[model samples]
Target: MLTHLSIKNFAIVRLLDIEFSSHSTAITGETGAGKSISIDALGLCLGERAESNMVRKGADKAEVTATFSVKENQSAQAWLQAQDLEDEDHLCIIRRVVSKEGRSRAWINGIPATLQQLKAFGALIVNIHGQHAHQELLKPESQRAMLDESGHHDAILANVKKQSHEYNKLLKHLQSLLNEEQQRIDRKQLLQYQLQELDEFELGIDEFPHLEAEFKKLSHSQALLEDSQICLFNLYESEQGTALSIVDDALDKLSELVEHDPTLSAVTTLLSEAQINIQEAAEELRHYVERLEIDPLRMQQTENRYGKAMELARKHTVMPEMLAAHHQALKEEHAALEQQDNDLASMNENLDILKSSYFESAAKLHSARVKVANKLSKQVTEQLHKMNMPHATFSIEVVSNGEEKINSHGTDEVRFLLAANKGIEADSIEKVASGGELSRIGLALQVLTNKQSATLMFDEVDVGISGATASVVGQLLRDLGERNQVICVTHLPQVAAKAHQQMLVTKFSDKDITETHMQPLSQEQRIEELARLLAGDKITDSALENAKGLLQIQQENLI
Candidate 1:
């Protein structure tokens, strides 16, 4: 329930603070007394679209703050905690600040929030019905929504939502499978070419290493042959003295000098070891000379193998060393694509299973709604009869044949029907309801949904009624107030007399400035205001007596 409202620099209201009672409250004033401004303030607080024109002249900005006592609002409390906002006890203050620059800000419990969040909270806090009710009756979708809201079918709707989700998943899977099949068709020739190239080479991981060794020998063939010939010449075949003979002569001299000194004996031992090493070097040099011959066929084979390896590496965008990993990955991808026909069949089978499961769940939800729709229409029409629209033919507008596609909402569209007179043809309320009739219809639907909603606000609901009809509206308002807190703004004296609490909105001028103020009317002040509403500019004796009598009657009944 809305407990307090504070407004500043909004149109005719410079500054005003109004407190509310938990029962039915009546707001009444003369014409042009800024009565609609109060409801406008509430609309701003509830995240309505605002413009800079709402700001008063000479004012920089406009602001509206509303406080709701959340002692019984468990869902709202949990939502606040989910957002990591404070929820100490059940008091939440939702404030809105609007600037002349078209900037707006919202706050919940003094924590800043966007307009979207403010709307989410407002949906849980209050339901306002004004001329907007006529606008709502125009849309068949809203009619369906209201019927579902009255029947409390959110759980069934949730199940339909889950089914819709599964259907979408299946559709996406089918699209992906088709896309892959198309790609395979486009790349058929390319895959065949690549497969033949790789297979002809008989590629292996160690093939590159063997080819690299051969290429090194062929590319430097002249250098390898020259170095081998030099070794052979020095050790065995050269006409000039070779290294091995030089060492031989040095060893013989050292052997002869060994008899002269023992130091010469150590030197003669080193020469003998050196002569043995040269003899082994001469044998190895003869073998190297015989084997250093280069073959042109082998060189050609190495070059061809290296070119093939380089081509595959460049085609796959990889380094020579990474060629092995790339080769394995392509082989796997080709292997997978080769079996796509079989894989596509498997995916289709899975999609069929998912679609079947989704349809089965949706069918159950549709069954539940079909069972409840007729009963809902009857209930609303019965309530309308009590609200003085006896001839109104109200029914749930649904396709009885169940031919529409099942969606997140079940396969039904609900709308109300009405006729003003006995001979009038029944038409949808969207096409044919008068101003006063629309207000009463909105009131009936809201009061009907009181069990689901937390609080109800009716601003100027008694717009198109007078005399005895106004009294019946008064009685209906009292009935609603008994069930839940109902705040109604009215100019009718009868409606004001029936409220548990009545508030007066008035504007008065003091020298240069005019201010609007709101306060709870005391019992005597309540009578004066009621008389003023009854007798406009002149307070007649009969009007005052009638107002006093109304006050006495309401007090006796309240007691």
Candidate 2:
């Protein structure tokens, strides 16, 4: 509930501070007295658009602050906690400031906030029903929303919305796949042919390097055999100065001098070891020469294998060593395309399941709305009767579109129909009802359907109502105030008299400035204000007595 409002340089309000209680409060004033200035300021604080014209003359900026007590408002508390804007003592303060240039800024709990955040948080605590709300009530969407609210169909509507979203998402994917069907077929066929070629080749990992080496060895086999024979002859088979014979001659000369000098003995030992190494090396060369042979057939076979590997590498646009990896990559791509085909095959069945689920939930919602519509129609008609339209017949028509149309709300179209007089056919409210009748019906719906907000503000919603009907509207608001804080701006004395508290708005103007002031009225002041509202500019003795009687009656009724 709103606990206080402070306005500065806002419209005609120069500086005003008004405190509110948790009950019905009536704001009354003469024409052009700026009765709605406070409401307008409160609207700005609730995140309404701000304009430069709202600022008072000569003021640089306009500011409005609204304070709410959220001790019992769990939704508001949760919102504040989620926003990290929670304050101690269960208090929520929203302030909006507009510069003279039409720039606006907002704060929640002293932290900077965006307008959307303020609007989101404001929705949980306050519901402002403007004087022209009846105009909005004419919309079919509004009618449907009211019906849904009355039925408490949030969970069911959510299910239907979820199902619809998923159905549309899958349907779009299926359409895309169908559109690309030919392209996918062509690509798949190409991939299949390429993969078949690669499969037949069956290139082994690291086999290309070994094949190249073997081809080189086979192609040079004759040259290799010739070189080995020459090396063998020089190392051991040469009869003149073979390496073994030279080493043997050196060892014999060193042995003959060993007895003359001990140093010669060490030299002889080294020479003997050298001779043994030379003999072994020569024998190994002889064996290699004997084994060396050239074969033309094996050389041709190796050359062909290596050439084929190189040709395939060029055809596949890969290095010879990378053919195996490239083959693996192509296989992976083909596998993914195949999986897409699989998904496309099963998508229609999935879409059908989703469509069925959506329709089922929509059907349940339609049933619930129909049931609630009947109850709501009856209750609103009863309220209309009390609001002075005794002959009014109200009904809510809920029609389903079946599978022809669907939306996030559901498949049901809700219409509010009314016949203001007897023997008149009930028709659409917008086509048949007058302005005053629309206001009454709109009020009835508001009174019946609004159950969430902690505070309800009716800004002259009783505009076309007066006399006994006005009194009934006041009483209805008073009843609502018993459960939630209610604020009403009205020119009707009967409505003002029924309030637990009252405030008077008066405009004062001088040569240079016009200011609007609002003050809470005392018991005597309330009677005086009510008398003025009843009798116009003059408050006669009878008007005073009538105002007192009205208050007296309201007090007795409360008991």
lDDT of each: 0.77, 0.88
Cα RMSD, model 1: 5.4
Clashing pairs in 1: none
Instruction: Residues 1-559, candidate 1: write the lDDT tens digits.
Output: 7789999988778998998888789988877778778788888887889888888777899999988877777777777778776567678888888898878888888898877887787788788876566677668888777776776568767876887676667667768878777778767657667767777766677677777787888878888888877877877677789777887788788788877876888877887887788788878767876877788887888888888888888887888767776676667778877776677787688767766665666566556665666776667677667667787766656653253453666555566777766888877887888877776676777777664336678778887777766766876888778767788889889889988899988888777676677789999899999999899879988999989987788778778
Candidate 2's C-alpha runs over 4 A off are 30-34, 47-62, 81-85, 97-106, 111-117, 204-326, 507-515, 531-556
Pairs that clash in candidate 2: none
Q: What local lDDT does model 2 show for residue 13?
A: 89
Q: Can you tell me which runs of candidate 1 are displaced by over 4 Å?
A: 30-32, 49-51, 172-184, 199-214, 228-299, 313-351, 400-406, 419-427, 451-453, 507-515, 531-553, 556-559
* lDDT, model 2: 0.88
Q: Candidate 2, residues 369-420: lDDT per residue as tens digits?
A: 9999999999999999988889999999999998985568889988999988
